[model samples]
Target: MLSPNSVYTSKKLGHYIVTILTIIAGSTVVATQINLGNRYRGFTITQLISSYNIFCSIILTSQFVCSVLELWSRFRTLNGQLLESLSCVGRPGLSQLLLGWRKRGNGEDLAARLRRLQHVHLVLQRAAELLQAHVSPAVTFHLMYSVVGIIYGSYELLVVSQAQNRAESMIISPSTSYSLCWLVHHLFDLVALTVSCSILEDEEMQASVLLRRAVGIEETVPQVEAFLRQIKRGPAICFTASGLLPIDRRLLVSAVSAATTYLIVLGQFGLR
Candidate 1:
């Protein structure tokens, strides 16, 4: 059986966490904008637009994040169960040594076990593909949303820093804080999504390794060989953002580099 950690046991924990964070962050953003609205009474239209934008962004980000968390939990359970099933077959080396001494029936039993594992792996692969398809669209939109928020926030922070000497520093400070807060939230979501997917990818790689080891080098059973061939020839089961980018640590590195470059360009423009 899979361990408790393999599956997400807390059924509503993700929902609770997302809801609590959304309320806190959403409230802070709205309240900050309202305070700024009062301070700058002349910019009524600007204040309303800002509030609307922030509200919509928060709602969309929250929805996507929650969906990802839920799907991730399901994926974790499926992966864990697969690993557990593989483990039940025991080590290939040990099985080989023991089966040689036992009755011929033991060899048949080992072959049966290998076939079952192959079936289980195929089922899990199908499930992962389905989950990937379900989440790709949301992931794509969330990524675009986050990138835009990060760019805008970075630019606003730069502008606010230059406003320190202005009479409206009080107004600028709150807006900057809101932007910074929004920026951090987006970064957190991106990091969490990528990290979770990376973990799953690593686990799947290990499982594939284990499957090969269990099959061993000397065994010539056609069923087992076919299973190995399937693993080698098949595409890797992993998450991708709208089938465009794999969700992994590499994506994080690229994202950070791109965001930094954009910020630098924005900074240069602000200076000019």
Candidate 2:
């Protein structure tokens, strides 16, 4: 009993799921080859896998830090605007005190308070933006990384196969790896999307209440829906621009393809 919109959304979600699975499968194949080659050259599978994870972690962490700084800068700008707005209004209910404080009191103290508020506001704003930008995508990335790790870890199977001179019996086919990786990625993305959507709905409800109070108009469902759509702008921009840029996608695919081919070749060689 799904509506047309619901059906379309489900189809779209399925497509993303397939894409992520392909990425995982490709990564696994590459990783397996890399690990096997290292092993053949006298490195243990554990050593190769550990080094790979360490490298990936460093890259991911650097990206995360840069994202945080960009978000922080945006928040600071927003907060400066809020403080400037407040300063223009100037000590709203205490006209006499304002004159006295502006002259006799340390102007520095008032400036400091304003600055502190600005900083606090900026930090809060940045945290909110970070949550909006990262929550779902981070979950998706983590899930994808986990699949990569698990499949890569399972190269121990290949190692054993090589050791026993039975590498052909334990080949990790691309399709098999891709299927498992895709399943994991899709499930994780679904969970992340559901949680993010729920939070967005709650935010929309709050915004509707505020709008109703300020404008003295009852908020209609359509109005609330429109507001919710507006809120999605940030996530949409982040995904399109920051999360899945063409360069990043190309690099990831290239790496996965290279790795998978290498592993297949190694498996064949080891069997001989």
TM-score of each: 0.69, 0.28
In candidate 1, what are the lDDT values of residues 33-94, reduced to their tens digit? 66666677655776677567656656655554455454455445544443343433445557
In order, candidate lDDTs are: 0.62, 0.41
What TM-score should be assigned to candidate 1? 0.69
Cα lDDT over the full model 2 = 0.41
Q: After superposition, how far is residue 211 of candidate 2 from its true place, in Å?
A: 12
Tens-place lDDT per residue, model 2, 1-272, is 12345345444544554455455445644554554555456556654664565445434433443343343344334333323323322333442233222322322354344445435443544565565566445545654554454345345345553454543345433333433443344333333333333333343233323323322222333432343344344332222123443212333444356546656775678445
Q: Which ranges of candidate 2 are over 4 A from the true structure?
A: 1-42, 94-139, 143-272
lDDT computed for candidate 1: 0.62
Best model number under TM-score: 1
Per-residue lDDT value at 86 in model 2: 30
Clashing pairs in 2: 21-182, 29-260, 30-259, 30-260, 33-263
